[model samples]
Every structure is written in structure tokens, then in C-alpha cells.
Target chain A: MTNLTAQTRHHLVTARVENKAGVLLRVAGLFSRRGYNIISLAVAPTDDPAFSRISIVVDVESNLLQQVIDQLDKLINVVAITELDPEEATQAELLLATLARSVEHDADLGVLIQSAGASIVEMTDQATTIQLVAEPTVLDDFEEKLRSYGISELQRTGAVALPRLVQL
Target chain B: MKLTGAQALIKSLEREGVEVLFGLPGGAILPVYDPIIDSSIRHILVRHEQGAGHAAEGYAQVTGRPGVAMVTSGPGATNIVTALADAYMDSVPIVVITGQVATTSIGTDAFQEVDTTGITASVTKHNWLITDANDISRIVAEAFHVATTGRPGPVLIDFPKDVANATIDYEEPGELELPGYRVASAPDERSVAAAVELIAAAERPVLYVGGGVIKADAAKELAHFVGLTGIPVTTTLMARGAYPDAEALHLGMPGMHGAFAAVTAIQRCDLLISFGARFDDRVTGRVEDFAKGAKVIHVDIDRAEIGKVRRPEVGIVADCRLAISALNEQIAKNSAAQSRDRIATWVERCLDWKQRFPFTYEGAGTAAPGDIGRIKPQFVVEELRRLTPPETILVAGVGQHQMWAAQHWGFVDPRSWVNSGGLGTMGFAVPAAIGAKVGCPSKMVWAVDGDGCFQMTAQELVTASSERIPVKIAILNNAYLGMVRQWQHMFYEQRYSEVYLSPDLPDYVKWAEAMGCVGLRVTDPKDVAAAIEQANAVNDRPVVVDFRTDSMEHVFPMVPAGASNDEILVHPSQADQPR
Candidate 1:
């Protein structure tokens, strides 16, 4: 048996479900009934016919992932599920944050952000909006990397993914 | 005519052309329930208030209309928060109506009284606490308009119990006037010009289309632009089916778990034209390395989205369809090199990459002699692909199997693939499949689940059986939550935890049979085809095919989140080796 806490690794998953009513309930019910704490989730349908894709990011043991997959398959309208390989997939997520503009003028703050892979997307007198697109871990690193520059408000788009292989 | 707030609520809903409302009846909502019984609107009694909220979300998502969810105040309203937040993040249009304590009991902490409006304020697009019956009609109308318009999201309207019962002379409100809220429609001239110039001058350009195209219903226009400009396109997870998956220029999803070719293209492109896509973390690992060579031009309807990621060379705050149409018009006038050769080179590169590390699974065609055998998840996905129609909707639970589905399932259409992509909800498949089956009754729907996740809400199988929703469930029973187990094996020195379910297998199957559903257990790989065939035969009720798979199996081609996309872990067992 895997040590639940010691073996657990956080994963961010995004799925596309048919754009129908009640699908979200079914998805959430599955997690809650199973006593899974979903750290964050973002769901929306694609531009295709009538389908909605939900992105759910959570933490669990790697050894027990199969059980999770099997349980997910039981949901009626869930068309497909993908547990993104943090190492192989080209994952990107959006973080829309409004930082106090007072710090934007700080030379130290400007240098800190530039080093953290973020840029000032918008600047207003009250807030300086910064945008960062990176892996969840890197984003975390960048967040820690930007502690010197205070963050007033923040919003994340959660994670979305595509594979990363070079074409010939 | 004089009417109660409840009656006005119903009228407002009817005026907005809402035919169905997903919710549950409770004490606080008795007044609304009374009027609902007399109204033409049909109410679906969900098993849980949370289910009602998600159901409304599903309805809104499928129909592109505002979903209506009604419930009692306090816990009922609170229970629906998850779905509300889900809709909020995904931009789904849903209106949640809750019954509050009587107006007289404002801050007295009456029985079942809670500050639901304040509780949901951060999660909803807008929320209102109505104390007066006369304001019901206007509030309801405005709620629907707000929820459906702009970047669609959930809206909440809390009605006091007395307000629902209070009688008043009602008249539909005039046009909604919210001066502070304005979604841009037309593209700014300078940005459009800059975008056109970027597209015209580029030797290698890519159109990163997103759900906004589908949201705007601009598929034809998007397709037209891709065809005319010969620019390759890649979609975000939410933008699947924005363009035909089979299109020559189409590079599949680009992000964590997206196609490699798409990522490489993003990395190598000279110019990137983004339509309705916000740069999320899953798509941009090590942000500085994201699209290192490209000049990005972002066009979106939400002004807040512009420059929300990498600073765009040209940021146009306008509807994608309008922007694309305007660009098409301008491109027609500007005589510039189409650069067909460059576009062709990129396409060739993508095709070559796809041929290299093709998303596939290898089966040894061997099974151990036991109740739990070595059945590969890929075989199930592959077999289902063969048996089901190409357009069949396949939903999956979160875990190792979900990754297998993404790798093995050949998605021919957009929306054909659905799951909890961002949240990674494990037990999402069964109910999502039910919703898909409900949305497209004529189409085949399959809920691909794993053993651990399947047992989470297996009770839903009873609902499918009783409701006569013929959803086919293929359980990838690896006995443990495989993804978690793999992590334990690789990172934690294989100290197994709660991942094993050796004693629970038989009970799970027995439970399915008791629910009046046909249950088939597959211990042998050879029986996979037959089991699927038998499950398909059960048209009257839901069918479960439990394939006992090897617990040691793992999802490969993994790119650890913080690492660069190029750094991949090819297999679960070999964690130290980077591909």
C-alpha cells in the first residue's frame, strides 16, 4: 500500500464534457461522495458542437490514480478525461492579477517581475495588472520569486494542456 | 394583473424562453414551488442541490443559454457553491435563484437564514438579495440578461420568503441599463491593422483558436480565415472542435497533455494570432520559454483578458468573430505574399512530429490467471473506438485512464471529448456521460471510469437504470487509483497506502447487479471485445463492463509541471530518466 500523504502528488486535470445540464453535478458528486478535496476547478465547453470541458486540479497519490480514473469513467456524460503528464505535456495557465501600482514604479519590483517570467499587462493608478503563463509549479516558484512585490488581487485561469513534441 | 413575486419570477423566466429549471424543493422555497406547480416551466428534481446547479450548468453549456437553478436558502444555497464556482471559472451562463428568510427576519439569524448573497458574491457574475415583491420581475429579467451576456457566468438572485408570497401589480421591465457593463463588439482599428500587418508579413504564422470562436459561433469565419491565410491552427482544451480536428492545418490541443506538434509549433512560430484564448499555465510552462520566438496578437471580447498573459504585439478588445471578419476584409485589400511554402513546411513538421511519439499504448496480450487480470486501459479505449460511432461522445473520470483516453482515442470532432480537464474530478465520468446522453439522446455516450472513481458515486447507476438513460460505462478497474499508486511507487519508494481494493471488487460488481444493470467482469483481455458487445446490447438500462487491469501500469510521456515541455518522463517506473 502506498503511503497516502508521502506518495501524494498534486495534478491539474482538464476535461471536455458535453454541454448539457447536470454534468457538473455528476462530476462534483463523484468527487465529494468519494471524499476527494478538489483544490480548484474550471469548466467550460469548446467552440465545437455542444460540449463543455471542465478543468479540475487536485492532489492525490500517484499509486492510487487508477482508482480515480475508473471512478471518473462511471460518470454518464463525461466524454474523455486526461491526467496531464506534468513532465511531457506543454501545459499553460493564465493568471490575471491586479498588483498595487505603487510597486510598479519600484525598480526592484520591476526587476523582480521580469525575472519571474511575468510582465505588466496593464497599469492603472490603483493597480498594476500582471499576467503570468507558466506551469503550476513554475507559477508557484514565480509567486515565491515575486514575494518582494506585493500582490493586491489575483485570479488564475487554471491549467490547460497540449503535448510537446517537435515536428520534423 | 396582480401577482406574487413567485408568479412574477415564473413569468420572467417564461418571457426569457426558459423551458426547464434544475433544482430541489425545500421549506424556504415553498412559495416559489407553489407558483412553479402552476407555471409552464418544467422542474427536474435533482438528487442534490449541487446537482441542480451543475445540471443548470450543463443545460446552459449545451444550449448556450442561461441555466436556471432554484433552491432554498442557507445550506441549499451553500451546497450549490461548487457548481457556481465551476460556472464562474469556465464562464458558463447560469442563474441560481434561492429562497431566503422573510424580510422581517433580516439580521436576526432566523432559522435557515444565511448570507447566501454575500457568500456567493466572489463566485458569481452578479448577485442580488430582493426584499420587495415588486422588484421580482425586473430583477429576474436583468439576472438572465446579465448571466447570458458578456463573458457568460453564474448569477444569483435571493428572494426573501415574504417576497415570494407578497402580492403586487407586475409589469415587465424595459431594456436593462447597466452603464458600467459593456462588452466590446467591434475591433479597434489600430489593433486590427497591426494584426493584419503581422499576418501579412509573417513567413510562419499560427492561428491559436479557442472556445471564444465556438462561443461566438464563428467556426465558418475561423475556418475561412485559416483557409484563406493558410495559417496552421491549434486549439486550447476548451476550444476543441472550433475547427475540424482533421483539418490539415489543425494542431491538436497545446498545453499540459496537449499534442507535441502543437507545442513545438507554438515554440517555433514567428507570429502567433490568438483568438479568444487566455494564456493559462497549463499551456505555458516556464513562461519565459513559452512561444520564445513568436510575436503574439491577442483578440478577445473581454477587455480584461487583453495583455493578461504575454504582452500582445497587438491587443484588440473585440468579439473574435467581428475581429476575424474585419481582418478578412482588410487582408482582401492588402496584396501581400501568402507564404504558402512556409505554411506547408510547418504542417509537414507537425505531421512528422505526430508520427514520431504517437499517443499509443502497447499490450502484451497476456493475462494472469485470477479474478483480477492484466487488462490494458488502451485496449478498452481502442475497442470502444471501434465499436462506437465516430461522433459518439466519450467522457472520462480523472486519473491514469483519462490520460490513456487522450492518447488513444482518435477524436474526430470537437466536444466529442469531455472531462474535468482543469479540475481533474475523478468521478466526473458517470454523471457527465448521463448529461451527454440526455443532450444527444440519439448519439452513443460512454462514461470511461476507473475502479476507485467508479465506486465514488456508483449510486448514479441506479438513476440511469430507472431514468432509462442508456449510458455505457467501461470501468478500467485497476483495483487502485492507478495515478496515485504510480506516484507512490516512483516517488515514495512504493509504500502503498489506501490504493488497494482487493476485498472490495466483488462487492462493487454485486452492487451493480442489484441496481438492475447488466454487469460484465472482464478478467481476460480476449473478453474485452465481447464484454463491450454485450454492454452495447443492453439498450434499456445502463451497462457496466469492469475490466480488471494490471495495477502496475502507468501513463507515460509525462512532462512534470514546472519542467520545460522538452523534459518528459517517458515511463512511470523510470522517473529518474528524462526523455
Candidate 2:
């Protein structure tokens, strides 16, 4: 059985695919059927309207990375695939958290949020919604700190990545 | 021209030169069926959707064209799933068109509605759920293109009821817009040169061929290469007829249930030249230990399959025909005299093994010690082969009977043998035989099936009878799930499980007669040839012959599952004999 935890090695695969119905399903279906764990996934239209780029963080054994790439490459809708190495790629994630608001929670949380590069997006009588745009690891840390303030709801937009600009 | 999506679908099929299609009608697919009636293509109305799918596979295998199957939504779509998976596993080209609920009601739990595209996505090479009638022709063209190209497999198009009913200006699809889909073209010159070097250097080499050779229509090229090099060739189950069985350099088959010489030669060979054959677990036995000493030259059209199993020393991603032609060219240029001279002793040794450890059964003409009123399946298969025309197409169901038929029947022509090799789907023979017979009406087709397999989809014989297809069927009725029973007998200390299905129950002859077939039952080994001759004589309709074979007879030269090929078990009688 494959280890599905986050601690296992994660391969960030970015696939440019035709922007068509059921293409995402086909891509996701391949992963599920093959029993490969998806740590995270993000999809959006690329610069070209005809194609969409899907960023997938797959938790797989080291030896199976080639298989993951090969299998993904077989999908008819997938135009191209590139494994974005962490050192050579830039990744970003967005995290939103709705936390309970009170005098007791407000003081220390403000300092923590500032240090973590998070901002208060919305404020209400009983709750405060915070937004964080950072690397996945920083987002994870920011989300963890918000947990102590009695979180009501939270969501993370999975990481999206691109190759870093090469120095000429 | 203005046309409904249904009309466009039929026109597209006509443009694709589809002569016949297997299908069943249902509410959601009624619109498409309406157009099929007026189309030039002959539509075979199969009794069940599964039969339709398998029949399409049969047609594709024999004709080298993508088999077409159509079925309705929901239950009908689900029924064909097994056949689709079977085609996917075997890389048989087929296009399955399934009806879906109207686009408006697709997710509203409409009547006879299911996610046909989603259900089949994994099993198919590619699939589409049509939303526009305008795109019907293009999708159909693309579907055929995908199904028949690069490691050909099944493709599907889920046609919704509204889309079928909608009108549009029908136009031929432009050049296929599939940028991502590309087949392996000519191999790298470096890889080809490297492979040729390996071929010229290795003293002992075995040419491992698979079904891809048949798919690529490369048997002639493969034969020419083998002839030039004098390399021993072993055809896998899917490749039984790819290489002529009577060739001097032919090793029968490799892997589990393969000929001893074939399996042992692969184990002992120094060079394993895999031509279009995936290193399937069934062929490799145990991956780590299979051909441990051999350097591999793997050539296949599917890039994913090349290094997916065994890492080859020289991997060439090219069509088998092209790859073989390239190798032959290089070999000619290199003049492999030293290689041929060095491998002479090795070739002689392999041929000796082939002559000595030939497939044999104990008491072939008589029953085993305590089992009276029974015939050995091998004898029945051998007699069937002898009685039938050499060019006859033999379709086999999965089990001991299938192995028996494969071992006993000598196939010389390509596409003469069709069996579910990769998936090992039982109940495949009956419908597939029907399809093969329909595709090649001039040829004699026979479905050599097991009783267990016969029970699964035997109703398709009724379609055969009603359509006046004269495909013969030989049911090796051993009154048990023969293959599973053999496993229980060998590894499970003879603790028989629920493998027994009484031979008398349902009375196969009566069942055949009920289905409008001329039924014959053979209890004596002497009567086997007579029964087959009688079946062959009846050319008006299908015939079913039930040969009451011994349940105890197991397929020999068995490489125990997951065991090393070096430890292959030969026949009990041949066990412990001097090498």
C-alpha cells in the first residue's frame, strides 16, 4: 500500500492540457484508479485560452516518479508535463480562515498574523476572516497558529507552481 | 448537408468504412438506432450488450480494423464494461458508442442514465461525452484514430439523447487536432545501432514476440528478421499465430503454462529481444528473476510500457514492423557471421529441448486410471485441430481448455487464433467467435470453450443461430472450474473448493438445441473426431459439441505464479527425468 501522508516524498507535476470537458476527470480518474495519492491539486486556464495547466502534488515512492510521469503523459488531453523541482520553481498557495473574534484573541493574534504575512480580509461581530498568500509551508504554519484562536472554518487553495525564470 | 447527430454518426461510420457493428437497442439510444437502419453498415443486434462488445473485439482482431459496438445507457453501458477492459488489456482496437441521458437531465437521475464516460474512462484509450451534434463526425473520426493507433485499444463516445436528436450541418472532420496524441515513429539511430551490436555479440538470443506484432501487421518483417539471423522465436499467447508454428527456429510460448523449451530458453538466453511484447507478469513469471542473465532489447509503440516492467538494455520506441525492418537492415550491413556461428550450439540445444519436452498428456486416447467415461481435453483439442481446416480461426475461452486448445492447435496464419490473453476473460469465445465469423464469413470459425465459460455467455449462440452464422463450438465439459481446480489440486493440498459444476446440470446439448444449434455430446475419446467432423459438415447454422473431458488433467510446464522461470514444473511424467 502507498503511504498517503504528507511526510512522504511529493512530486509536483504540472500538466498543460486541452481546455475541454471531462479532461480533469480523466486526469483525476487515472490517479485514483492507479492508487496514487494526490497530496494537492490546482487547475486554471493558462496564457492560451485553449489549454489549462493543472498543478498536482503527488505523494509517491521515489522509484515510481517516472511511472507517474509516464502514466500522466498517456492521457490524450494532456499536452505537456513538467516536474517543477522545488529549487528551480516558484510555488504559491492561498489560505483563508474564519476565526472567532474577541479581545482575548485579538491582541496576540494580530502580532502573529503580521509576523506570518497574513492580513484580515473581513471582520464581523463574532468572527474574523483572515487571508494568507504564501508558499505552502508558510501557509501551513499560518493556518496552524489560527487554530488556537478557535477556528470556525478554513480552506486552502492547493499550491500552483511555475518554472523560475532562467538567468541569461 | 443538414443532418441530425444520429445521421452524422452513421455517415461518419460509413466514411470510416465500417461494414458491420455489434449492438443492442435501448430507450436512450433509440435515436441512433433509427439512423443505423438506413445506413449502409450492417448492424448485428446482439442478445446482450456484453456479447456486442466481445463480438466487436473478435471482429477487430480478425479484420485488423477497429471493431465498433453500440449500447444504450445505464445497465447496457455497465454490461459492456468487462469487454472494454478486456480490449484495453489486450490492446485490441475497438470503438464503443454508448447512449446517455439527455444533456438537460444528465445529472438529474434521468431514466436509464449513468455516467458512461466516467465509468469507462479508465478502461478506454480515450473517450468523449458529446455535447454538440456538430462535433459528432469529428469525435467519431478522432475516436477511430485513437482506437486504431499506437498500442491500439478501446475508445468510447457517450452520445446523449438530445445530441443525437439535434440537427446540424454535417461536415467531415478536419485534420485531427490531437496534439498530445503521438505514436512512436522511427527509433533513434543510436538505439538501433546499440541493439544490433547486442544482437551480433550475444551467443544465445531469443526473440520474444507478442500481440503487438499482429496489431502492427509486422509478422512478415519479424519472420524475415528471424530467418536472416536464425534467432529462436517464442510467441506469447496473444501472439500464437504471429509466427508460424512449423518454423524450425520457433520456440512455442514463454512464461507460465508455456512450453518447457520456450520457458527454459528464455531463462538461459543471453539476449532477450522483445519485439512489441510487454513483459506481462504472466510472461515474466517473477520480474526480478525472469531472464536474469539476458540483456533486453525492448521495442514497443507504447512509451509507457517500455520500462514499466523490465528495464531493457536498449529501448526502441518504434512500431514493431519499422523496428524489425531497421534491425534487419543493420544486421545485413554488419554481416553477423560471428554471432550466427557462436549461437549454432545454443540453437541446437534449444531445438533439442523443443523436440524432447514437447507438450504431452497422459493417456490422451484413453481415460486416466479411475476416471472412466472421460476424455483428455488435449486429445479433444488435438482432434478438433486435425479435423478443422488449417486456416480456421479458433477462439478460446479462459481455463484449462483454453491452454489445451492453444497447446494442441497449430496456428500458421496471422489472426488465426483469438483468445482473451491479458485479461483472461471467460465467456469471451462464444461472442468473439460470432464476431470473427461475421467479419470473415468465408472462413470457418470455431469457439473452443470450457463448460464454466460456456455457462457465462452461451446465450450468444442463439444470435449466431438466428443470424445463420455457422461457427462451431467445442465445450470441454470437465464438470469443474478446471484451472482453479488444478490450482487447488496442486498448491492447496487437494482441498477442493466450490469449483464443481455438474456436467449434467442444464444439459448442454439440450441447451444448444433450445438455442437452435445442432448439439453433439462426446463421452468417448474415439467419438471426438466424428463429432467434430459432424459439426464441420453442418454449414447452415452453428453447432455445439460437448466433450466430457477429465477434470484431473492439468496444463503442464507450469511456472508457479510469482516463482522464477527457472523453476518451471514440467509434466509429472517428465519430472525428475534426465536433462
Candidate 3:
């Protein structure tokens, strides 16, 4: 039997769309209709307010990536798209993990926190919150460690990426 | 000077050179209808909104203009949905204007309220909801542009009641600017060169023509290209008349129920030059194995259709006219075009297939001199084809009869045949034939319908009779959806599965008489010609001929739906007989 850990690839796609109210819905609706799961989606104002840039990370079967692009290209609101391959793009995710204060107080937790590349953002007698800013893999590892400490709250902002440049 | 949005809509249509429109007036659309009463554009009031939409399609198909339909919202809008989807599926250019509830009542679901745009979003080529009076001219212009351009499909513009009632100072619409929808340019030199290179090298090559050639108005270019290349061609169902059926180079339609020679040639060609045709499921059965031996060259106006099915060795994105013209020029320059004697054996085989499997009905040839009763559907279609002129427009209601009509009729020129090909819409013939006659008022129009299909939207004949549109209707009354029954017989253990319809129920003759049309029921085979001639003689009103045909007849040379082209089912009893 195949392992339950699903084998999928994350694709980072950036699109320029009209800043109208229904634009986002139409785009997301397309993703759902085509059966592509959006791992994370972020939209922000670009240089021109008339249009905004939407960054989406989707986990899909590798063979179906071109079909997704083709489908997206047909949507009228989408003006342009640039797909940054995982290896060619610089990527990062910001994740906040809140854990019980008992873990921080017990077993030299300060060294573990420093070594794990997590910074404390807030602390109280009962709870402790730490922020991790790093590559997606590093963030995933930190979240896995926080879950064992009986975490009270956990928030992960999906990956945001830009194409990495090599000097000419 | 300011004009209300309704007046502006009519004025804009007039400016676009629209001579007529087909529709019905209802509560939500009364404001627009008021302006239309005095406008030069003639409104052909149809019995149903679906009829109106189909009539518009018929007009567009024959005249090569964007057919226009108008209707009220809610039920009126929903009724016309089939026409929009039909036009969409067939890639026929039509613009539909519909009334919506007042702007304030849109979300509140007031009287005759429906989200017309939302319902039609997927089916339409493009759609717009009018919010301001000033937006009419631009939106109308855009709708026409989008409807007629590219692959050419239906466009709908939803006119809210309040917006139509509002007034604005209208100026002439400016230049067309479509940011997202761009008209395709001619294919680059390399792709055209590559296509020609394949054509010259292959010993067995066939030009697979389709409706896109007719849609592009490229029949002349296609003829010129084929003439210069000296290559044999096959037209699809939607492209019945795109090429002259009388020509020796013609291989007839190629698909399910298509010519044996044409389907076999597609299966065996060394190089398949697919000009302006999508390899639809019907055409390419067992998609993985279609055109097993051919190096395909797909040229279309739509880029998405290129790799959407079978990936071609060389794909060219350009208008059919430009692409074929370019290929012809390249063939003229290159020494690659093969000589006539080079592929003589293959051509001979195709000619043999054509002769061996000519579309025929049982007892059609050896009938006794004065034989009467139990008319064969193919026989009726052939009789109609022989009676009609070269320039006559033939439309069909979808069923076994539609297939038979396409197979038997010798369509001599482009834009001479119109049917619901992609959508296979039942009850398409009468209204569409009305639209065709309206578009070309001087030409003879004939609607070939099936009994099962005719019952769906036969009310449109009333519209034709009232409008004084004299067209001929030949209902092959087999008393069943013959195609469906044929399938049940072939594959489903002959269950017959609710496919039969009783003849006395509708009484087509009485139905026609009630609609103010002269109805002729022919039970005898010998009287078929005389009945058709009598129908032809009448020019003041429409005529319906209820031809009581053989109930067991089936469209042959069948691909059996999901089966491969090689697995065609020939006529059962005549399997061993020579053509």
C-alpha cells in the first residue's frame, strides 16, 4: 500500500488581475473548479491601483501544471501570469507558534529555542508565543516541535516567493 | 440631445446595419420594445424565446452576420438558454439582449428577477450587465465584436429595467479595444513552412475541413488552396457545404455517420492537414488511437483547440483563410507538392469506398414503379435534395434524420447548410429555417425535421406563417427518436427504451393547419415528388410535409458512439450487397 503522506508538488504562480470585487472570487473559483488545491494565496496592491498582484501556492500533480496555466489564461480578469519554479525562486514563510509556559520553564528551553531559530514575541505565566521567519521546510520543522509542547495557538502565513536572480 | 438607454440600444443596432431582430416583448422588456416599435429594424415576434434565438442563429448562419435575439428576464431569459448554448456549441455568432429586473431589485428577487448573466456565464462567448445608460453603445459594440470575432459564438447583454429607462447623451461608439480578448494574427512563417513541408513529403494527404472555414468566410480561399495543392478533402457535419459536394476531390463528411471513405481516409492518411476543425469525440473515436499513421497539422483560429485534443506535429494559429492562403503560397514556392500519379493508388481506394458505400435505404432502388406508403427517411431527403435549387438553404432538427440529411443532400456551396451540429438540439429546424429565410429573403429554405424532434419546438412554425416566411418543412415521421432507438437496437439488447412516439397524438398535419400552414401528409413514396413541388409552389405561407417514413431505418456507417472508426456498423441486410 502507498504511504498516507501524499506525494505532491507546490507551484508558485503570480498573476496580475483587475482590482474589482469579484476578481478574487473568480480566480479562486477557477482553482476549485479545476480541482487544484490552493496551499496559500496572497493578494496585494501593486504599483497601479487599478490592478493587483495575486500570489498563489498550489499543490498539484506535476503533469497538470500546464493545464492549470491554460485554464487561468482563459479567465478574462487575469492579465498576466508568471510561474516561479520552486528551485528558481527565493521563498519564505512566517509562522507563529504559541506553546505552554511550562515547556519554556522546563529542561533548558532557552537553548532549544535559540538553536531551533525561533524568537519569542510574547510571554506570560501561562503561555508563550514565538515567531519563526525562515524557509518553508525550517518553519515546518519548528511547527512540528511546538505541537509536542501542547501548543495553545498556531498561525502560519503561507509561502510568499520571488524569482531568485543570478548576477550577469 | 439625450436619449433613453432603450432608444440608444435601438439606435446603436441600427448604426450597426442590423436590418431585423427576432424576439418577444414581455413585462421586464417593455421599455426596450417601445423604442423598437418605431425603429427601422424589423422585429420578428416568435412564439417562444427559444424560437427567436434559433431564428437569429439561422439568420447569422446563412448571411454571415451576427444574429440578434431580444427577450425579457426570468422565464423569458431561461427559455432562450438553449439557443445561447446551441450557438455556443456550434460556434455561431449571435448577440442576445435580455431585460433584467430593476437595478435596485437585482438581489431582492423582484418580479421576473433572475441572474441572467450568472446563469449564462459559462455558455456565452462574453456577457455584460448594463448599469448606466451611457454604457449601451460601447457594450453593444463590444458584444458584436466579441460575438463575431475569434471562434465566433453567442454573446448576451443584460439590460436592467432602470438602466433602459435612464437617459444619456450618446455619442458614436469609439474604436474597439479588448484588453483580454485579442483577435489572433496570421500564424508565423515557420509554422506555415512546417505545414507545407509535411504536405509536400506525404504520399497520402487529406485536407480535413470544418465549420471554421465557413465561420471565417474562407470558402474561396479553401477552394483556391485545394485547387493549387490538388489534395482530396473531407468536410465535417458543421462544414457540410464548405466545399462543393459535386467535386471529385470531396470525400464527404468524416465522423460517426460520416462517409466510409472519409472516415477510413482519416484513419489511414500519412499526413492529415486539419484546417479549421477541432478533433471532437465524434470525429475522433477512441481518441488515443485516432489517425494512427498520420502526422497531423492542426490550423485553427483558437489556440486552445490545437493541443486540446490530439497534439499535432505542426500547429498553426491563424484564420482559416489566411492559413490556407499562406500554405498555398508556400506549396507554390516549394517543390514538395507531390504529383497526381504519386498518390493515385490511395485516391483510387478512397473513390472505391465512396462508390461502394453510397448512402442508401432498403428497397430505395428496386421499388415497384407505383409503390406507395412506408416512406424511407433517406429517400425523402434525397427527393428534397433533388427538388431544391443549388442556392437553397437546408436546416435540420437533430436525430437520425439530421444525419441522413447531411449524408444524402449534395450541398454545393458554403453557407448553404445550417443545423445544430455540436449541441444536436432537437426542434432546431423550423425556427432556424425561418431565420435563414429572413436573412436571405429571396432564397428557398427547407427544414428537415424528425417526428420526435419536431414535437419539441414545432410552435415556431406559427411564427413563420404569421411573418409570411415561406419555407418548406419535411417531417420524417418515423414515430420515434430514431437515432436513440437505433442505439438501443445495436447495443442495448433492443429494449426500445421510451424512444417511441405515437403519430396520432400530435397529428402533425392538424398541428400545421392550426399554425396557418398548408400541411401535406404523404404515406405513398410515389407522391413525395409531387407533394414537395406543391410546397415549393406556395410562396405566401410556410408548408409542412408529414412524410410517414419507415420506423426501422437507422443512420449507417456508424462509429457506434464510443467505438473506433474502423469498427463501423454497415447496413445490416445490405452488408454483402454492392453499391
Please tell me which predicted candidate would have the highest DockQ against the true structure: 2
* TM-scores of the models, in the order given: 0.72, 0.95, 0.92
* Candidate 1 CA-lDDT value: 0.73
- Candidate 3 chain A, which ten residues in sequence have the lowest lDDT sum? A1-10
Candidate 1, residues B399-478, lDDT tens digits: the string is: 88887776566667655665655556566677657656666678788878888778765666666677777888888888
Supply candidate 2's per-residue lDDT for B290: 92
All candidates: interface RMSD: 17.9, 0.8, 2.4
Off by over 4 Å in 2: A1-8, A99-108, A123-128, A141-152, B364-373
- Candidate 1 Cα errors over 4 Å, as ranges: A1-168, B332-337, B364-373, B486-506, B513-516, B570-579
Those runs of model 3 whose alpha carbons end farther than 4 Å from true positions after fitting are: A1-10, A21-45, A56-64, A90-168, B175-177, B366-373, B573-579
**How many residue pairs clash (N, CA or C atoms closer than 3 angstroms) in each of the candidate models, in the order given?**
128, 0, 1
Lowest lDDT 10-residue stretch of candidate 1 chain B:
B363-372
Better model by DockQ, 2 or 3? 2
| TM-score winner | 2
Q: Using lDDT as the measure, which candidate wins?
A: 2
Greater TM-score among 1 and 2 belongs to 2
Ranking, lDDT, top scorer first:
2, 3, 1
Give DockQ for candidates 1 onward, in order: 0.02, 0.69, 0.36
Query: Tens digit of lDDT per residue, candidate 3, span B1-579?
Result: 699989999999998889999999898888999989899999999999999999999999999999999999999999999999999889999999999989988899799998888777667877788888887898899889889888899999999989989989988888754556666768789999888888878888888998999988889988987777778899999999989998998989999998887998889899898988999898988887788989999998887778777878999988988888888888877665746665778788778888777776676665442363578888888889888787989999998999999999999988999999888899999899999999999999999999988888888889988899998899999888899999999899999999889766788899999999999999888898999999999999999999988898888889977788888777776578553
Candidate scoring better on lDDT of 2 and 3: 2
